[model samples]
Target: MKRANFIFICADQLRYDALSATGNRVAHTSNIDRIGARGATFHGHLTPNQICSPSRATMATGLYPRHHGLWRNGVALDERLPNLWQALSRAGYVTMGVGKLHFQPLLAAAEREMPESLAYWAKPGSERWRGPYFGFDAVELVMGEANESTRAGHYAAWLRRNHPEVVDLYEPEASPASRAEDLKEVWKSAVPPELHYTSWIADRAVDFIKHQSNRPEPFGLFVSFPDPHHPFAPPRPYCDLFRPERMPRPTIRAGELERMPAYLAEGDDPKKDPYIASGEQPREQGFLLRTDDISAQTLAIAIAHTHGMVQMIDDAVGRLLEALAGTGVLEDTYVLFTSDHGELLGDHGLLRKGPPPYRQLLQVPLVLCGPGIRPGTSLGALTSHIDLFATVASLLGLPAPATDGIDLKPLIEGRATAVRDFLFAEYHPRRDACLYNQSVITKDWRFTRYPNEPAWGELFDLSRDPWEHWNLFSESEFSSQAHRLNSILDQGLPPQPLIPNEVLGAY
Candidate 1:
């Protein structure tokens, strides 16, 4: 069998149900839906970590956060580890990476020499530097999430050099109407949709596909979009695509946090809290709107803005598909679409991600469309971001690297209905702090365990509480159920290292 060309597109902080095909009626994602139309969409797909860098590292190396040594967002992936891109390159494939490649710290100290750092890119000779980053033969990146002040990488340079007039338009406070005093994160950007970074990423990806189609070596292209991550600012036309009134109200059950961990509940001061003061648990600082303080209108605006960003990405995906088809490699290539992790768009009274392994932050979309893959099927078996590396190696006929993930090719080819019984995720935010969280999720249940606080944890019977509104960890009636899941969690935990990995920076 001939080795297949691969095109993997990833979104930053996209929810699983953000696409129209995923039953989101408010969002128009026709282009993304095409991938699902031509192939299979995996359900119960979760990220090993909720944040950007750790989850992306898992995808790149096929190892859990602990194994890969990127236990948090600010840390860098170990270069010595075998990554998917380098493996494909060794197998005679041309590897290309475009857009947000958050494999390194984006906001580290100036002396750290992090390539993804804004300060590094702003330096004099940084313009000429590109290639062999994280094993990609070539790369074009937008370092961090969409923020005007913090913009850097290849995209920022291009915008400044050619389209300087539109730089200020990228600011959240550019337009008066976009400035929502109540919700600082929600904004309608003044920059035109065509000039947006999402469009620029698509442009580069299309060019790469068009250019590579004429070459002999099979290509492995990763086009990662940074939109839909945060600071929900969509450019004009796309920004107005969804109305705030039409957006669904967030699912916030009254007094739901009381059942969960104490950190999740409001009116708890970090300075006063023993766990936080002792540096055992990281502080749960607000990420934009607080769950209890957010008004319905504010939440609606943020959701609508996020919907707009999704719509923009959908249109961009359409362009890439067209490029592939136009280059005559549509049938010869496998196109995989997924997100690094998900966002908490007002789910369970949470505004953004945190230590808790909630469904909203962990469950992301995974669509595999290509030859020999079952089309129009939805596989509900447990899956994780780590699986992609092994799956890709299998598709390319390369020796699968030593990885914690299983070969998902069997599930994709309809050879098996189930591959794994359970999925695992972890989050260790700070080295100094003991906020080590491990979660074991089965088809019927979701359980998160905080080792430091054995008495406080989360156990949700997915069958009954699909929304995860109720935490059944402390309930005596569900003690047996929690115990079984806790055992599974114990098996998933990796052995602690003798020397802890260095924390490069705070994310």
Candidate 2:
């Protein structure tokens, strides 16, 4: 076995633009920035299936959403596929997944959130909770990201119930108003508890690194953190870190809906306008879901609070780094920090995730730092999260497994390379009865196919319109480009596939 090990850190729903190294000013991510300075950073990284379960399954199997059959959340990954963890384990590597294994092995607790319409619906088996995930030696999970009301046997609650001092040593703070919406009862209750969830997870990781010794060889630890996801609840200090007045707001145009396809605005049951004009305040006329109750500054607080959550996550990352160094496993570990997907904070009149694929939820940040990696370098080539498994394999000198994701080692090593020419992502319920959306992105262009034929479809040139406000699907100039990208859609993708919606619009 190779003497080196791997430490992977994942931030839940962390946007690519939220990192200071990536030009996000409103927030701070010093630990991530330090890692970027030590190794290579891919600014163009993306998740083919940009959601929690699907993208994480992609990361595990090194397969595309089509190949893995985990194209949607709350669905099971095809059992037939051989994953990186399993392969590495067989090849004499110590593979231990530390956090957030979103793969749906069974329909029980952790996997319960998966919709029944998806395939391979079953309950989480003994292997789901028991260690050696696919191949990892140990796994202490925090039940697919939980809160007070929906505590799903997560690691934090486990620690709080048992080992609370670990948190005190690393993060001795109270997360005021960091509870779930349903847990508002506990939000204002007494002196806020000492250990927060994010820190608790990190504290457990530190203990695991220092104590766990069952592995016979070097380890590859998937240190996953389900932070900055939903609830937007960082503790009191972090929660109030940023003021909304200083944060930037979206620049909406009057003709925004005119450029977009009609179906995008079709789901407005309350008769709200599909698009909000520039300089106009957001109206609650069914334009968006999720953000049901909004006072004037509530939206602003949500934005600021989201950034605050990100900053809190940043501090947690620092603690993890300190643990790695303290454990005397610093140089021997190949560290990877990334997110399953980005969070769309008020982009496209959207609040939280699901229901659609906005840029705020699609584009994620990827920073890889360790031996043999170039520091502070950015690859302009487009990439996808499915490439993670293969990249890990390459770093360990293991053969790339049979999967749809491309091995990004060449691009990361500063080799100007040809990675994925065109990337595609899928979302919706995995079960047959549920509908979904498919998005195709090329270097310059993007096309989204909506299931159930919503209001309209979206097409944009990311190079020209990073905000993705312009819908160029109706433009005749890109007819050939659209066809060319569509041809590479991998017809023999994975196994059973989610049906792609036919868009009948102007172009």
Candidate 3:
């Protein structure tokens, strides 16, 4: 148990049905559903490369984007190759990577074009992510988690220049509710409900895990959480803790977009996209933009304010798992919750996970509890997230280093000898609103291959449309399961001419 230390816990676009241990009867996780009752909860996990800095550079370099090519999201990861904190600090652990290390930098020296936002971030500098990328030894950068007063711009200017509210719950539009219609999430029918930014990223991730268990080695913390991702803000009695009259609508069907598949009915002039359009989302007064987050009255009050900000990030993952079982290190640390991708929240009317291979933005949520595994078990066969760098290098016995992923300790220990049986996905659209697509799911077929540029391609038959609401690649009744996941997405990935950003150029 001592050799295990890994505490990962990343969450951004979250949604594996926002957890109630996955049954989600309307999520409110009593401690992120007790981390699936203490470990092992695959639930068919998958997310090879689905946006967000190429899925946080394939989980900090377990490679895939054709082997660390970082397939898109403001480009940037050619950090001279080989990562995962340089193979867990060359096999000794102690990694540390607090909140949103979507890291950016590597290419700089005057605008050769890349700083498109963050007000032209130091010329080629702005690609989202300000520093320490993933070589985290320590990092805390929460200057703002979406404008509109959240953390009152610089945490209320450093709590009016140092702790004045004294927990009186100061308010700044309960800051951190940036959904942009000029930022929102207004609260205060009298104070007591402020301090938001998902409780300032869960009390700075439990005081950086109680300052890294007051040092003694054996650590790898990477606690990230940017809120129910995007300005569908959170903080104000968890913004009306869901009840847009029991929200939950848009399971999309009506005229079933005339039999999907021409790039999912091209939902936004990808030459008339109606591919079961569910593109934009954010309501309760505004947002819903991929040309309107399709009404059912703005998707039931934006899915009850995204299920009350996923029960306030499951009460901030139950206060970072009660500060890791009150420092007894919760059965010897390993805890690896998930989500760098996943959140089309509206499901098909897509809220924001950009256009491509949408299984509500490529099926994410790959829980793996801790030490050895099997606790309230759930593996559903397929899994990836580049196998968390060979399942944390086989839980620290080490050795799968420069990872391209695939060593899920024999499917989180239920044992089945899986070296991956068809599951791949990728889409690079830097933004023409969002469209490029490519997907290949297998243990029963789900191919999506949008080549119309704007982005569209789908094929689901989860044993006959399991709520994928029908989109069978021009049904010849599932042309041999969409030609066997498009010939395994044309012979799986990797081997593209990459590597060469000794700053920014080749890769």
Winner on TM-score (1 vs 3): 1
- Identify the leading candidate in terms of TM-score: 1
lDDT of each: 0.79, 0.62, 0.59
Rank list by lDDT: 1, 2, 3
Q: In candidate 1, which residue ranges exceed 4 Å CA deviation?
A: 148-150, 176-178, 266-289, 431-434, 494-499
Off by over 4 Å in 2: 78-80, 105-130, 144-150, 154-160, 163-194, 212-216, 257-293, 429-435, 451-456, 490-507
Better of 1 and 2 by TM-score: 1
**All candidates: TM-score:** 0.94, 0.79, 0.33
Cand. 1 TM to true fold? 0.94
- Put down candidate 3 lDDT per residue, 249-270, tens digits, no spaces: 6566654545654434434321
Model 2: lowest-lDDT 10 consecutive positions: 182-191
Ordered by TM-score, highest first, the candidates read 1, 2, 3
Q: Which regions in candidate 3 have their CA more than 4 angstroms from the true location?
A: 1-7, 12-194, 197-199, 202-210, 220-226, 229-231, 234-256, 260-341, 345-348, 352-357, 363-386, 393-395, 398-419, 424-470, 482-507
Better of 2 and 3 by lDDT: 2
> What's the CA error at residue 458 for candidate 1, in Å?
0.4
Using TM-score as the yardstick, the better of models 2 and 3 is 2
